[model samples]
Target: MNKELEHRFVTELENNQNIVHKICTLYTNDKSSHNDLFQEITIQLWKAYPKFRGDAKFSTWMYRVALNTAITLYRKSKKRIQTQDYDSVIYKIKTDDYDDTEEQQLKLMYDAVKQLGDIDKALVFLYLEDKNYSEISETLGITEVNARVKMNRVKNKLRTILNP
Candidate 1:
């Protein structure tokens, strides 16, 4: 890639690296698997970079590529298991910028989100990141109405976990 395009790609990745990590974590249970998924998604994004047009937001295009990569990539393990404690997870996710309570809530929420099916997890991840239904639909190749309905169900499931 040329210097300008390389710089643009780096800028985009830096801006949205969290989204990539979030998707990888949502889809993979273990750290090794998460890393693998992250690498795979990065490869897909880098490969798809040449085709990205400037019409949509860079993040929007990223979501499309990342979601597509997540859905289609296959790993040998499919079982969902919870091995990390919420407190530990919270501590790990915490940054200097994040409040303690927000970190705790995010960790708790991530634990509950792990129980959701892959597609539902995708919806919740997108929703939490403030992506609109239209954007979620486009990213996941689902209808907007379906995105809304699935998100409502995911929310209810989350509420049950939090309240239980």
Candidate 2:
């Protein structure tokens, strides 16, 4: 890659690493699997970077790549197991806008969201990341009205998980 393209890719990756991490967390519970997923997402993003036109926001495009990569990327191992236990892995981190309770709540929310089916988890992830209905629809290849309906259902599902 040329220097300019390399720099742009690095800058974009730095800006969007959290989204990759969020996807990684949604896909697996083990630290090794998380790291593997993160690397896979990063590799997929880099591969897809060359095709990114200026039609959408960089973050929006990045979200699509990450989601597609998460959904379609192949893993060699078949023995990996899914676990729903986030209680032992939960932690609170400081954010500019969140208090301790909010931080904890966010972590717990991710835990609950992680328990959702793959597609629904992707819906909730995009929603939490502040993607509008149109962006979510484009990313998931669904209609805008379907996006709205699915998002509403996912929200209610999350509310039940968070409040119960």
Which candidate has the highest lDDT of all?
1
Best by TM-score: 2
Reference-based TM-score of each model: 0.75, 0.77
Clashing residue pairs in candidate 2, if any? Answer: none
* Tens digits of per-residue lDDT for model 2, 1-164: 78899899999899879998888877776777778888888888888888888698888888888877776642333345545456556885657975578768777887898767667888988987888888899888899999999888888888898888
Q: What does candidate 1's lDDT look like per residue over 4-100, in tens digits?
A: 9888888899889999998887776667767888998889988899899877888878887887787676333444344653543553554687668
RMSD of 2: 4.7
Model 2 CA lDDT for position 68: 73
The C-alpha stretches of model 1 lying farther than 4 A from their native spots are: 74-76, 79-102
Q: How accurate is candidate 2 locally (lDDT)?
A: 0.80
